[model samples]
Target: MSQLELRGIRIQLRSQSSPLIELPELTIQQGEIVVLMGPSGSGKSSLLHWLVGDSLPEFDCSGEIRVGGVRVDALPTQARRIGLRMQQPWLFPHLTVRENLQCAQRGTETPAERARQLQACLDAFGIAHLSEQAPDVMSGGQAARVALARAILNQPAVMLLDEPFSSLDTATREEVRAWTFAQLARQGLPTLLVTHDIQDIPEHAQVIYV
Candidate 1:
């Protein structure tokens, strides 16, 4: 189990003198989801980007991001092992569902083991039947689940979710949200979820009002 910690975080947009966000300390406990609430332009997504080592150079970042004892802010995006899901699935148009998940794996394991892990994610998402289908052919909910599975297969030390369920319809949102929380709980990873809607905050999650 690992905790995600941020210390003395600050970010300034391009040409802006003032920092948009100035956070002194934020720590997400192991196996818990921390819900981040703020208005649309409050730099919530930018904060997540900084943590995952994906923030643009246009935004000056100052902070220490740590997962367990390792300083992830010093690592490159690929080496950070921090998973991120966004409003858009952004599944590759050319890749099939199974291939999308398989390609996301940083396979130190044998090919057979990697394939097995892919199959497991497929079965877990109930998308094993749709494994060969293109992402465009799937429904919105399927696409979201597939994208989430791919993110999980990335095998991060922590996960960042930015309005992950906001794009879905009412029924689909409820379904995906429940499934997502269950999966996150089962995986036992620290997760930071950013959403404007209060209803999206699960009962067990910690709320960080920004």
Candidate 2:
């Protein structure tokens, strides 16, 4: 029943008086994906940073963010219970794929149950073979898949994606995008996706221009 709600969102450069992005309200229900599209410097990513509770030292942001009717804007990033996948993959270079994914474990599942889900996710993402490899050894596509697996494993209340499929080949990109949307829908995770490509938008997604 968790839904992401944002009200009175306004972001602006600290050095300027004009707002970079402003929206009166936005709501993303569980199992729903909302796409944010805009030009290169239109504050799409900045809005997501604000949602994820990231430090925006260069910009000033004002908004109310809530999940399931509870305020989360004042909470720390981790405390806000949101997962983010950026264009860079952001996997741990020092750890093996499996270990990196293990770092995302946050549920109370037993060891056996956890292992089962991990393998299932790896297989689902077509990355089971890369489980023992380091991030540096994987291709951009592989790394992206691994990064996505970790993000889902984290089981956040909301998922924020920042051009997550931009690195994949055409065919892989479509496949991964479809699978990702399906998985998120199945899990009932509210999602906000930022992308420049219209092809990235899923059917029925609420598209907002920044």
Candidate 3:
């Protein structure tokens, strides 16, 4: 069954000007990837913001955001169980790569199990050696990888990506996109990817143009 669903979703930024988003309905099945594409200011980011319960106070939202069959619109952002990856990576500058990943681990019954999960994730992302490295010391691509590893370490029911590869060069972008999709598939988690770049859309992605 699909882990994420948006039904009759509509959002409007309370501008002195006009509405920001007009999405009607969107659904993502388990392990599926849905790509949202539009030009800048077309509300792509706004839609993602609403899905994860981060709709700005200046925005008015009327919709149902469901994750694993649970309505999450009324829930706090931390309770949504949705992992979000933005273009800037958003890793904590003060923490080492391992600490960032460790902080995101979820559902483990014991500290040893959580540590094992974190170590496995770092190994899978090919960043096991970076465990002790500070964010500022890593290259851009490496930092982005760490950010993604952290986001998935929580084993979210769904994942939301906002132009996550925009900072990478062409080759690196493709590599990371493939890595991300593969990881999501392995986790059996539905994903909503928001990006203006068409190349970022994977082969099986269902595209929504806003």
Q: RMSD of each candidate? A: 1.2, 1.9, 1.7
How well does model 1 score by local distance difference test? Answer: 0.88
Give the TM-score (vs. native) of candidate 3. 0.93
Alpha-carbon local distance difference test for all models: 0.88, 0.89, 0.84
Per-residue alpha-carbon lDDT of candidate 2 for residues 1-210, written as tens digits (9 for 90 to 100): 789999999999999989988989999998899999988888888888888899999999998999888899999987888889998898888999999998898768999998998888788777899999999988876787788789988878899999889888898898878877887777789999999999999999999997
lDDT of 3 by residue, 154-195 (tens): 767899999999999888888888888887788888899999
Residue pairs in clash, model 2: none
User: Top model by TM-score, which number?
Assistant: 1
For residue 95, model 3's alpha carbon misses the true position, in angstroms, by: 1.2
Error of 2 at 49 (Å): 1.3
Top-down TM-score ranking: 1, 3, 2
Preferred candidate (lDDT higher): 1 or 3: 1
lDDT of 1 by residue, 53-149 (tens): 7857889889888888688788899988889998899999899988888889986999999888888888877789989999988989999989888
Off by over 4 Å in 2: 107-117, 123-126
